[model samples]
Target: MKKHIIGTLLLGGWSLMMLTLLQSCDKQEVFSYESEHALFFERWKQVSLSERYRLDTVNYSFSHYVGVEDIEHQFKINLIGNLLEEDAEYKVIVVDSLTTATEDQYTIKNPVFRKGRSSDSLTVVVHKTPVLKDKSVHLTLRLVENENFGLGYMGYTDVRIRFNDMPTQPTWWTKEVELAFLGPYSYEKLETIVAANEGFTTFEGLSLTEKRKIALNTKEYISEHGITEKNGDPMEIPVY
Candidate 1:
């Protein structure tokens, strides 16, 4: 009886080990890309990653371009397989149902993976119009299989761009900026600050002294002009 029990335990251990080995082999085969070339949209580094990587959704605005006529919005596309000696052409198509911009509002440029490069830029020419000021528009792009490349990583195959010319708060207006220099933010206060300091777009890259100086100047300007928010609240800057 003792010998039979030991034999049974040994056989079960062998079977479990074999099952694990087979599953490991299957996973390796799934992840292996021996000779296939694939393409995926690269995530922007400035944003935090959601799960394993950041989603390829980009938000753009023309409000930053005070005098520019048009903006060439660009996104990075990455290659998965080995680099080629010659340039490889890739194709991108717009999901019409998901896109809200008309043909005249934006133009998509041809995408190419340059020779010896692992990545390339996909550019879209976004035209600024009066309509964009009041409402936003969206353009969704997807990578399709072409002669030179295959769609890679289902999650990264698509990219969505939301663009507008509306006066929205800049991403640089973080809690740190408010606690350190700027106080509670409002569109009116932002406009007042920009008016006081020519081309003041961001609180970044400015020294503490410089930011304080500009804030003081803006405060004086607000007091002199009696500028108030759209809600009729007093416009104040806390630099002290």
Candidate 2:
């Protein structure tokens, strides 16, 4: 009777093992030759499989980089299907209707997936034109189907990049900066302060006394010369 029970247990275990193997085989992916030649854009830093991993648009502000003529901005293009042993050139073109930047304002590098690699960097050279100081421009890049590659994910086939040199209010302009130092924030005021104060970019790590002195000097300067904001409002600084 014991031998009979042992035999039955062994038979059941063997059957379960075979079922698990079959299930794994079913779940395995089978890629056709045509399906292995697709590409898409995704953020290289994201490790998640969620939809957020797909990259659609990116924004850059040349305001952060003062005196920089141009910069090379790069984003990742990933392979959806298979890695190749030989280099594969991909086609990307700017959508003229969606692009506001002039031809000389930017340059797109030739996109190519290097040999034995599944991804490559698509670089664009963005120039800091005078127009960007007051306004922003968009550069939209779309992937075109070529002999070597096809578009991968539907929504991630293209990316829009908007760049500007316009300076916005810094985060360090807290309530303290408003009530105790500068009364109100203005782009013109900030520009004036940055111009007058050498090597002063942000108010992030200044002492209270130093801030008070700078505020007093700026207030005097504005009062003496009558510097107004772009909206014609009087630039005022609180005195305490």
Candidate 3:
């Protein structure tokens, strides 16, 4: 990743000055400004595009990560600049195309954004039921036209997400590992390991370092037992 421009700007990026400035400015400069966030009708929030997600098998909970930037605070750099308070709501519409109906309404864990804070976000949690195991789910959440935030980045006002818990090989899982030990990508192998080993839980539960440890540990497993897969076809983790 590139380092942002040193100092001065809160973040290294260009801002458009289409609207008139709220305060006095130099000949060609806008001294202060604020963006209003708005979500158009049926606009899907740009979350993740068909990304793989993991479930906490121990608790049956799912978490979708999203971020909110302090665009207003970043503009308040001048001596007379001011930042306005903003709010974000967890407005979601379930796609009726799924085989099962999603009724979990505990969307936003903390929906309020108090003043003075640079930025904040809703936890945006999803609770899974036993019925979801066999159904495909699609969720679109938009930060609609709320009085709190009126302006936002285009194509980012809302996020459309499809949820899945299958433990497929992630990007970090290398082809080298696949050739040497694990077959291809096996959800069944992942399930077997987690069910047998108390230490091996959800893939998300492990830290980056811990996940790395599992990679080498898996190599050891393959060396001792020969290459293996719980399910036929496609590579996967070796289960005990």
Candidate 4:
């Protein structure tokens, strides 16, 4: 009887151990393991088209987070379009500059894609730059395609730029200027219009409504002076 009891206890212990091992295996398969340094794609913000022409700038800004200690990030820009023929020519101007108002202070390290590729697509490799922690960098990209594809489709097709992490800053601007040329005529134009006006020197202590009215009147004054022109052209504008 003593031998039978010992044998039964050993069998039950073995059964419990097997069950625990099976549960562990099942949990491992259900969970996905990802590295701490993986990067992701963020949404792109479209800037104003009028600003593009006025400031001669056109681009979009995007950002993603990296959680690794030290790892190289890799990314690519992919363009997709059926309208681009094999012989069509295109240009991509990638300007790497600091986001400041100092005139032409940024450097253009990579001016790529002057001619279209033999295929209907092109890809540009983006490597990591030296950047500080918790701060974001900006990359200005201009896609100029020389072809006639109607009003809306004149430029590059299916445009998207990708970014990867680097240890250093690529290039950026310290300060930027906002030009509100149409502030006086628009309903939402604010007090800043007075500052932007060429004829005004000081609007020290004006109310919000007073400032808006002044801006509207300034718009009329400029129109009477023939300082503005209107065209139905549609273009891409850059917004900060």
> What's the CA error at residue 85 for candidate 1, in Å?
1.8
Question: Deviation in angstroms for 237 in model 3?
Answer: 7.2
For residues 128-182, what per-residue lDDT tens digits would candidate 3 score against the true structure? 4444445545555444434544434333334444544323345533564455434
Residues 1-240, model 1: lDDT tens digits: 999999999999999999998976653323222337888887646434553534477777777555555778778888888887898788899999999987878888878888888888888888888899899999998888888887765566678888899987788778877776667877667777778888676777888788888888888898899988889988767676
The TM-score of predicted model 4 comes to 0.22
* Pick by lDDT: 1 or 3, better one: 1
Mind giving the per-residue lDDT tens digits that candidate 4 earns over 132-226? 23343444444443342111212221233333332231122112211322221221122223334544422345454644555466556544544
Error of 3 at 160 (Å): 1.8
TM-score of 3: 0.46
Worst 10 residues of 1 by lDDT: 26-35
Top model number, lDDT? 1
Report the error of model 4 at residue 111, Å.
Answer: 10
lDDT score at residue 191, model 4, on the 0-100 scale: 24
Q: Provide the overall lDDT of each model, using Cα atoms, as 2-decimal numbers.
A: 0.78, 0.77, 0.39, 0.34
Clash counts for the predictions, in order: 0, 0, 13, 23
lDDT score of residue 71 within candidate 1: 76
- Per-candidate TM equals 0.68, 0.56, 0.46, 0.22
Instruction: Return the lDDT, model 1, position 127.
Output: 88
Can you tell me which runs of candidate 2 are displaced by over 4 Å? 1-35, 43-54, 170-240
